[model samples]
Target: MEQLICLEALSVILGVPIKPGSKGMSNVNELNVENLLFSTFFGNLFNGGPGKELFVDMNGFLDPQFDYDFRYCNDKSICKRGDEPYKRPCGWYRFALKVLNKYPDGNTWLGTDGWRSHSVAGEWPVSYHGTTIENAKKIVKSYYKPGDREKYGRGIYSTYDIDQAFDYSREFTSKNGKKYRVIMQNRINPKMRKVCKRQDYWLIEIPEGTSAAKEKEIVEKSFRPYGILMKQV
Candidate 1:
């Protein structure tokens, strides 16, 4: 059966290896820097004035004096709830729409705060697809340190927990009378907040004969709760 892996969970199983020349930066650390600098500035700039300005990205926009934290716009209305509160003409939605329309070219100016404001440290999930269970296990083992290898004896370590969030299997008979089964797995990493768990997911497999359009539709439906996303490697 084919296996699906969460990208972030794969990192944890592999001890969250820091990239070469990364200077020991973790995802949480990067998220912090993003929130402190970019989010604080753009958030206020858009929500501060009337909701009709195109946010140009040049100049000394990073100066702290220009970094205003408009607390009024930071509520769940702008970040979470999806009703009248979110659609209010004077709300962050209007501000976001204006920015998006003006810069139909791209969202480099529209930082990630609007979509990911609810996702805090530890709650973020990563994922991968199209691999085997044995291969996945081997990949995780490859990241073990010398001490860890010595202690755990090669590919059998328990330092990290692999939460097999979903496992689905179904059998089908093709027009040629050949029988096949599709197996899919969704794996999630440990959450940042113990009480407020996040449903991080990655699909493991699609039945061999499924069309590309069907596969896309399946993944898109699964990914909606997490917001608009691009295909993950």
Candidate 2:
């Protein structure tokens, strides 16, 4: 419901009040819900302002298969602070997405229960995908798409380094006029991943059963989106 309050905030910012059962509802309809998130779309997120009420919670929407507690990261290496201009300080406000059961047919990759870089045997390595706010929310609402860039031959393009992800991060201005970027935190199946260490990309080949990971839809079995990472630019 916080996301709703964010819509109210947006309406308030525009000097319009939401009248019950009126077209004011259109101000906060389904298609653009993510666009008006107060907690995420505004500038006061770190200052305990009303923007605090804008975080998107995945409570009732979670599939039973993805019901698990996700971890918060504080590592200095991968989760670098904002000292780097290209990258967002890692792991502050992460909203977990459904992932666990998305690839049930493959041998379950382990060690990603926390969404961290540390991996054990058979664990898929962690990666990051920087995208526009529109695309980020689209994947969260739906599922991951196959690679949009085919420089490496049509696979989901990602990076093991947060810095690289930041290089690809898309920037947008919020209704509040604050600039921001969105990053997808994920764990990729090493079995299907192609690492380009020199180029800093981890290209993941499309899995077989997905009709091209359900080309029209996004059921890509080779990768899973565990968290949506947003940062004010």
Candidate 3:
């Protein structure tokens, strides 16, 4: 079994370390000059703003927001029901994301895939990744982090459960003084996943000692940020 990480401490420390089979960690952080500036722009991504027009659709149209019925969604996860550890899309609003729909192409889009299909070969499972305000902006802009070394290995952290990911998400105030939490909804590569059971996380590993360019390549092939899930607190 692997050691668990107390996610609450992430409020101050950003050096996160965890192991496989750990029970804890539901896993972001700070405000800085760059963040201050980025936050101003990041505000555009909230509920609605001109910035959202950036994400395109299969038809190359702006803002690929899907049509969803809040009344009763087919996927119970997003139906606002408190089913269990495996169910939840509650409170969060999803912004369409498909950075480059070519390579990691699949049907894991917003209302398409379910937990049962997680084992489908060539199909990645959905997961949520929490991060600091600055990193979230950087990730949305740059698309990869090269990850960091941890007790287990060098990889990006994400969970199948949104609530767990919510535990690690950092809250930021929009220009309007409204507070919100940001989470990256992703379809992790089944081939690259390193399952951390108990906590329901996948540490998508990048090889140790990898060159900068190589690391970039690995993280891209291993992870894909496909949607932005936001919730107002």
Give the candidate number with the greatest TM-score: 3
Please give the RMSD to the true structure for each candidate, in Å.
21.6, 10.4, 14.2
Task: Report, for every candidate in turn, its global Cα lDDT versus the true structure.
Answer: 0.25, 0.49, 0.50
Q: Tens digits of per-residue lDDT for model 2 on 1-233?
A: 33343233333332233222322234332122222222232222223233223232233222234333222444445431111112323543454444444454543453534333333556556678887655554554445677467666665788767767878877766556766566676766666667665556877655545584265333355566565555555
- Cα deviation at 53, candidate 1, in Å, is 27
User: Which residue segments of model 2 deviate by more than 4 Å?
Assistant: 1-57, 61-75, 78-92, 98-118, 137-142, 146-148, 197-199, 206-219
Q: Count the backbone clashes (under 3 Å) in each candidate.
A: 5, 2, 1
What's the CA RMSD of model 2 in angstroms? 10.4
For 100-214, candidate 3 gives per-residue lDDT tens digits of: 3334353433333433422333445677888777776566544556445364566677777877888878887654466667777676666777877555766877766778887
Give lDDT tens digits, candidate 1, residues 70-169: 2234343333121101211111111111122222234322234434424343222322122233333332232111112222122111111112211221
Give per-residue lDDT, candidate 2, residue 178: 69
Q: List the residue pairs that clash in candidate 2.
A: 39-54, 210-214
- The residue pairs found clashing in candidate 3 are 29-132
